[model samples]
Target: MGTDWVEEGSPSSSSVVKTKRLMEGLLLQGKNSAIQLQLLLKNSQDGSDGSGSSSEELLGKILGSFAQGLSLLGSCSESASAGHDRRVSPSSGESGESKRRLNLKDRRGPHKRSKASQTWVKVSSTGEDNHAWRKYGQKMILNSKYPRSYFRCTHKYDQGCKAAKQVQRMEDDPQMFQVTYIGVHTCWDIMKTPRMLIADPDTCVDECFPIKQELREDAKSDLTNDNVPSADFFLITGLGSSDQPNGPASVSSERMGFDDANGDHAVPTMYPFGDVANSHGLEIDSLSFDGDFSFDESEFLASDEVIELRN
Candidate 1:
């Protein structure tokens, strides 16, 4: 009962292999850069060892982080190699017989090749797409002044979203970043209306912000007739927790409880950008702070139930 659905550009693709090799080369380059930085730091400290001053301390911190990055790069290289072997090994012998059949079968029927469009955008650092992405990995790249940051859909684990992208700072424009997106978002498209969004186990948020952190846990708000969550609802994260300085926010169907009289938990709430947060750190604003990032914000604004920022 195996499926032959190969990823858009698995190790089997020569292009992907070339890209991997390029990435590895970049990792090595980064390691070398780190080593050079350490040497420079050592030379600077030749006259005065253990100054313990702010400059020396800063250099030490930078060098230590670089060393850690080099080690992680070594592990990443090995993992990539191991994954490649796993993907190509079976095709080498009789063990691949069933796999071949499955791949062929997967290519047919519902498993047909997908037309997921891949797009790239050039922008400044901290750039963000319309959707929420969770920072997963950061790697040193070859010849680039800035390290590459890897991000995947925030819903990857929660809603089975597989969209991912890589961001690299441009050498010419250090303040700018290059974002390469891979995979179309199979999840809901912002879900302005409950009818437009298929409710799932995932706590829905606007395309702009995702419900990443639990802001409140014990602080319960009485669900009066007006405050009750019904079919369409969204959740907000990143604001200070209700329990801490911000504390944790909780939902109570009655006056102070987790669920309603029927045992239903509270529906999630959405965060409005500009007024509360800075586009969820997307840095989409052109005017910088004291301004707002413009996108299809109207979608989220249209939803009345999703905009209850403060309880």
Candidate 2:
């Protein structure tokens, strides 16, 4: 199915081609009609007043007919296209597989065919569309009731495509917002325009303020005395005495102890990989120190201590 659907000028291209043909046909007809009108007007000037009145009506009718022909041609060119924009409505039945087909009338462009200025983008939905997704993992979050489902392209290895999606069903609605990523991972591109590229509606503080090495060192130092002990306790409980070790004991040791009575950890979390962290590279301190960059910060970084100096 790779090349089956990719025609040079798909339906849109064909519709445009048809429109051009119709305009050419109409242009030739209009030229011939204009020549006939010119000849009639020259002869009518020599005739009586009644002859001039009849000639005006005849010319008007010819122009009116030409206008009607152009309109009909536009509709016909649209109809001659290949496919329709199919929209899937919520199913009435429980089966979920049921779909109703809609025939949307095609629209033709004016004589000037131009590409759409704005791009049409789509977010994926597990329950909404007919596309298939493969499950990568299920994460049991501490506060949230439902676990987040991570998905990667099912055709990834076969097609060498790196599209991925994260599906978290809304607590209020049954509909899941499946973000269908079109392209592969381009983290640099995303980091360039943090606000525009990143879909997170959350604050830009994370990107604006890259984690300072001093703060990170402080966090590590703060945890060095306390975390090591708790992590050691976690290792003893999870591993149950294994020399070889079944898996990476560090995960079970560090993560499990972060939980409280509700089994949720209380430690300030840092990213596992330094990919994003390094990209920002101490930019956060400058942004944070500067009063202009930091404004209306929420729960993420609630506490900020500013030392005042008397001038």
Candidate 3:
């Protein structure tokens, strides 16, 4: 390296001298490697034996390695010269890096904040506004498991709305996402629904159910004022312990009304032994036959279930 230094137009004094010496050393290595290959080839020519041919092949690989090293040195020398020629212009407004940053700024355009932002809340739905949003960007958050996605009003560019939002998955629950909003939407963006057309009650009954005119008039009369039921509407079941009726009734007139098997009107059929307990297959021997009917919900349910299953 001390004897092989050649002067070149490299910028740094130390680097220029070191690079020239490095190229010379690599060139010398290549020359020596080539001489070794020539000697091996002579040995191969003397004898066509396995050992002689193997030595030639091995020497050829050594020469190839030296050639690669020389090529690397040549590249370094060219790069050094090119870098020395590259210098900042005195008359230019900015460096190449600053010009590149300006171009990038132009490409990015501008971001304007909202004029008014009064309300903010955390909600569970993506369709929070009912006003549509458009996704803009997604970036990986530092030291966080999930990436955050950015959104803005769909009318941001067209209508000049400045609203922006960032939605990110919560750390504790990956299924839940937290959204942060930056601005309020000023655009008149909303959902449109079909108008509700209500029909008159008389027309609805005429078209839907198609009731007869007489029946429709009777319905209207019944709904206009409360329809009072007759004496037959009151039924008696001997509930005498803790519960009391709204008003007392004569024992003879307090009989329950029962619908006949074949008709709709009340038939007042007499139960077996004048006691309704026998209808449930239960007989009270101690109580008289004229006693009131005692209803048991459990017994009634079980009896209905059995009858239903049998049918």
Better of 1 and 2 by TM-score: 1
lDDT ranking from best candidate downward: 1, 3, 2
**Across residues 181-252, which tens digit of lDDT does each residue of candidate 1 receive?**
554343543433232123321212222221111212222232111112221323232222222223222211
Residue 28's lDDT in candidate 3: 48
Query: Tell me, what's the RMSD of every candidate?
Result: 23.2, 28.8, 47.0
- For model 3, the stretches where C-alpha displacement exceeds 4 angstroms are 1-102, 108-119, 125-129, 190-311
Query: Model 1 off-target regions past 4 Å?
Result: 1-117, 189-194, 199-311
Highest-scoring model, lDDT: 1
lDDT of 2 by residue, 149-216 (tens): 76655544443223454555545544544232322221212323233213321111122121222322
Best by TM-score: 1
Model 1: lDDT of residue 57: 43
Per-candidate TM-score against the hidden true structure: 0.28, 0.21, 0.27
Please say which candidate is ahead in lDDT: 2 or 3: 3
| Candidate 2 or 1, higher lDDT | 1
Query: Against the hidden true structure, what lDDT does model 3 obtain?
Result: 0.36
Write out the backbone clash pairs for model 3: none
lDDT of 2: 0.31
